[model samples]
Target chain A: MVNANITNKMRNLRDAYSSALIELGSKNEDVVVLDADLSLSTKTKRFGTVFPDRFFDMGIAEANMMGVAAGLAACGKIVFASTFAVFATGRSYDAIRQSIAYPELNVKIVATHAGISVGGDGASHQMLEDIALMRALPNMTVIAPADATEMEDVVPAIAEHSGPCYVRIGRADAPIIFETHGEFKIGRGLVLRDGSDVAIIATGTMTAEALKAYDLLKKEGIEACIVHMPTIKPIDKKLARKVAGKTGRIITCEEHTIIGGLGDAVSMAIAEKPVPMRRIGVNDVFGESGEARQLMEKYGLTAENMAKVAKEMIKKY
Target chain B: MHDKALIKDLKRKALEIRKWVIESVYRAGSGHPGGSLSIADVMACLYFHEMRHNPKDPKWPDRDRLVLSKGHAAPALYAALALAGYFPVEELKNLRKIGHFLQGHPCMKKVPGVDMSTGSLGHGLSVAVGMALAGKLDGKDYRVFVILGDGEVQEGQIWEAANSASHYKLDNIIAILDRNGLQIDGPTEEIMHVEPIAWRWQAFGWDVIEIDGHDIEEILDTFHEIKMNEKPTIIIANTIKGKGVSFMEGTLSFHGKPPSEEQYKKAMSELEQEERELNG
Candidate 1:
């Protein structure tokens, strides 16, 4: 169970993403934004309002929007395309794989409303396997920023990085966990707290909870180091190795399925290091209609759950 | 348009491209020779006559782009690109082979002259729309041409792309439908029935124009008269499934099959005769 006061610190990531895009648009004249008629929801309408000529509304056709983004990328434009994660990933995967990833085009697909935090939109809207699908592609840089401030940094990072990227964001508000001027790098992890008892490697919104869990674990005399992995594709293997060596025990966390996402990426890297690890995530199941806070409780995604899961894994090891 | 000598040369080139299509598919032991043979004449017109491109400078930003949406018919485009000096004509034999650039489907990254990578059905037109939109935004004079298989239009995404192209008023892009009326299963009409296909594009606000695809002069003249300053155009080219070789044309067998040794010999002989006739 959560303290209910965490919501006070939470801010909408979509609005942060919107401001980032406008900033990127001002700096780079070739930066273009596209939306599949969800600009209002996805917050790309900010960029559309500021740079009308550079912003294209694809009118709810996500697949076409993807191809158009690739085309703009092909023509040397840094394209930021947005929609819900479900439609951006599941609906137009072929376009992303073949047109964008295959060509290694400079298209930044910044999709919001990822994971069950999309809430009452139900099973169809909740995208749990997008990270797996996108990470499997050869050239796609898959990312899920922890909060609004992380998203602000991640947006320009992908724009500056010349290649196809899938930046997943949640609909629900999340606590800011990074500084405004913080230096963010792709394929690297940020250590929120240092400890030797265990490593809590988390991504997306789950990173915020993992930080809270770290505080709880510290109070219980279990020193768990928290590493916030923003970029999932180029999973920080060096960081994984360092953490595994230091702590020798690890628990991966995500707001996604345990299979082939942050869990799989971390496990595949830490496998060589051979640490005793247990992944805490949605145990390969679809989420149902519920409020974002209620879904987190029902799905065992709260800080209390993370601290509990960490204690059990420590006992087992 | 009245230069009979130029038309004669283009006809000979089409036949040559057709011969290479059969040779490459037969060598690879598997390819879609039916669809490849169908688009030879039109592809020849685009590559050698109508479009502005420089093979020596394939990455020229202003070069016209051609996306073969019906990418299973890659053997045809491969031959056309080779003939245009994009690559070696000898490399045609290595199509679909391990470590070969000439893949089973068109890959723009691997192939020299390919503007967009395409293989999945119904994606070419969208890419073409993207390229056309890019050209418009950048104020470039380059035109984007896309070829879609008759059956490929059955995909919902094609309609999605169609709606956007007209919505954006992409006057610099043109789509050609290889309306051969045949697919892997059987005739397109019997398979899924996408009839009134011309009117469908018209309904999408495209300038629909129907023409005989195999007529070189007609194809050339059609490109010369395109209204690229007004709206995106869709040329519904009525063509045979396999246009060149006698036994292959209009037959469903070659839709996805490479010729046997005997069939390959016969196909080559027929193409050789056509080449001689055009050379005269």
Candidate 2:
């Protein structure tokens, strides 16, 4: 029993991103967009059409694009650099680290096609380690929205933020988790369901999976709460601690490397105030080319896998 | 901004920057003084004479920006910044101290006036190109200057940035090479030759100029010529490594070695006389 009364016409994360761009482009004249040959992919073609002068096609040069974004920020322009997560994080990590993070400039690095869901493009195009790279930087605010609806709010919030920020989104159409009208804030966790048996901490496409697991566990007479954590850097310590207090067992899930990512972040946050936890992510291995759905299932990143992990953890609880 | 007065003032500052390079490194007991002293004159002309910027508002939209691509020569840039009213000149003595804004290499967060933090070599020019391209897109008439060492150009990334600057037609970006001919190792020509340099830049679609990097008059005139030209400029400023210091000038051993207390005194006396003549 899911709530059938709630509208299914809610926007996906990509739609939210385009809608926010149109809104922000209208409000702020200083807001500029740069694409690493992927405006159509990231859905920033709307901004390109509306503000033609402000949009730049850097073209397969992610490092130069990042450096340009930093320069624009330094020169009093609000810059949103859009590209695939692979190039935005992997190809230009050093540039972002030195130019943007080291200087603490206000550049929004908006990355689409994140996680293993990027799929058949294969492991080369897939960016499974972006979260870890961006979060490790000193002045970067790392974000991976749970759904398209949440992406709409996160984009503008990152624009208002006066430091380096990285926002990751997926390419494939997933369930619209948010109602599209709920209030959103960066650096704050959004609690989707309330329970006490076990806690599932999730981000990006996996948030929807976590919700599915919550429903399955409830039917099986297990109470598991779901927390969609979008902003990974300034993590929601209050929400994390509160959930850990109510339910002593926790499971962290993401579509990233097991090391230096959401799992590591949550584990360290709880270590300060001890808690028992298990991590759900790529098991410290590289991804290969495959269907996004198949890859997610193969890597044990599905609702079934989450439910299984929760059941195993409940015995400990 | 008369050429005569500009040259007179910039020459005075250049002498003092060279002196500070020797003195600060001597105080630290170890630091790169040769390259720092080598580029003092070029840095002086760029800051006090060539580059258009406001010390009051460093981020002024129309203000010209400069990036020290060869960050090891930060002593010279830091000295020039102090004289340009970025911060108190007294902060120069606090170099490398923990919690001090001034680090061995320029850190943009820690320092007030550093445009980009450029410790790792072969990185700053791409950033400068980006700034210049931003200016073009914004319709702002700001020029960007980046200074590279003779040896630093040996990096493959430098060529990548150069290719990119030309490909994008980033004419607003001017790259000045301090052809001091010496790097941390012996002469750059001996270690790795980067000569036929002007042809290389010209091939890359730049308006190239060669000047005696030490001659204040030539340096000032070349910059003026560059501002009028629509193409990007590269001034290959030929300079002596440990310029103005008697025993250290043009020598490879002094590239990173600081002088002893006695040598520091000798270098100071020589620079003091040069400063007087420059001011007069």
Candidate 3:
């Protein structure tokens, strides 16, 4: 069911987010978009163009932008606020927690430039712990779509789901994995490939890497089952347990830090019937100035690293 | 000039709101009374006279909205909400209690008529700006009233919101700054000097109005004055901290500390005497 030439077509996920937001604005007059001086980067400017009256540019204030989004949501507007993931999550965390999440407002915080893949900007630009910060808040639905196609579905899905949601996307173009018409739900996981030897659960851009790792492991006669988990807050617990029970060995991959991210979430989800698992992500350290691919390789967020980790886990336990 | 009869009625309502503020905080055993009492007159005027709202239909889409940015004054807001029939007056007694709708801060989800949930300072104005911007987008005439504490303006987000409100030309937002001149630790001037607040608002492109916060007539007149402004307006309502209660007035102790048994009796009797004087 996976695409054969996934890496041939690379598209920035923010493009899909922007187009989907435009579509959402056309369908619902109450849909409003706001950006805090990153409209060009986050791609919320497309929605602003289509629905000029419904769009708000909140200058450079991310905290006030979150509060304004909450206020608009309070007045029955399906609000989508965008900025870089670091500012959207860390800078305005209290505003999101107090105004949006606490009231359970229908505000979708769609942030771009997540993970260490925001290269050349160094650690300040790269957001490594947005998932941890967002998922910890109650009533916040956290999602990180794997590729552009999934992001297209994610935008409208979060718009229809009436509550506070945080959707993180990347700055760089990623491998095109899912079809354009693929379905997306807030808390469901998709099984991209079926195997019995080991289960590799991945999210965001790392899911594409996991697909490549599947072929890498296949060359070594190791059959791998790949799961694409977009939603991290109300995580796919049933899938986590089922894959853990079926495969006996599991590998979790993400572009975020190993701490309090997909790795921790999967660990807690499969803890009832625990198995030997390995987490493939950035170790607890800050990223440096380099190309995105080099940073991913340096941080060990690669298909080769995931395949190696799976092999190590299989041998050790 | 305002109608004497109407002014008297609003004064009575303000006194009633003050009584409820004292009773609710005294019942809860822990709540902010100083700021709550400071804004009683304005809250009474807004909920009863100035705003267009239906207590029965709290979710009425076209109704005016109010965000109590200085949300520690929940007792005051809860009192005004109850008196205006958003909920039963008896519910004010359950403020800050376990499993009660009247939370420690104003929560829009738990309580009806709470337009926005706010406990953290500096959040209310931005939310109100959003609401006002929505009103403009929908071409609705519904106004958003936000009550802010003078101390809360120290938050950077407040300035951000101020910039957005005027930048968008959100004429539908009317912010009432509860200039009680005091904060938790000490006076606002000594703590963080929010003086020359009128000039600050004017510089932010808001049509600034100075009025007596505790005076119902002046509060009504200020609301009327801003009814036709082409820009966002801020009413700098100069007020004594802990107004109406003689011993508590102008003191910083009763800001979050609930009245003792003796203090509670004195406060209630003082409000009762004021009510009697107003009737005469």
RMSD of each: 2.4, 2.6, 1.2
Global Cα lDDT for candidate 2: 0.84
Please say which candidate is ahead in lDDT: 1 or 3: 3
Task: Tell me the whole-model lDDT of each prediction, alpha carbons only.
Answer: 0.89, 0.84, 0.91
Q: Write the residue-wise lDDT of candidate 1 on A73-164 in tens digits.
A: 87788999999999999999998988999989999999999998889989989999999899999999999988887788888898889899
Model 1 interface DockQ: 0.71
lDDT of 2 by residue, A126-178 (tens): 88899999999998999988766777778888888899999988888877766
Give the true-contact fraction for every prediction, in order.
Answer: 0.60, 0.49, 0.90
The residue pairs in collision within model 3 are none
Best candidate (score: DockQ): 3
DockQ of each: 0.71, 0.58, 0.89
TM-scores vs. true structure, each candidate: 0.97, 0.94, 0.98
Q: Model 3, stretches more than 4 Å misplaced?
A: A1-5
- As for candidate 1, its clashing pairs are none
- Residue pairs clashing in model 2 are A12-A148, A13-A148
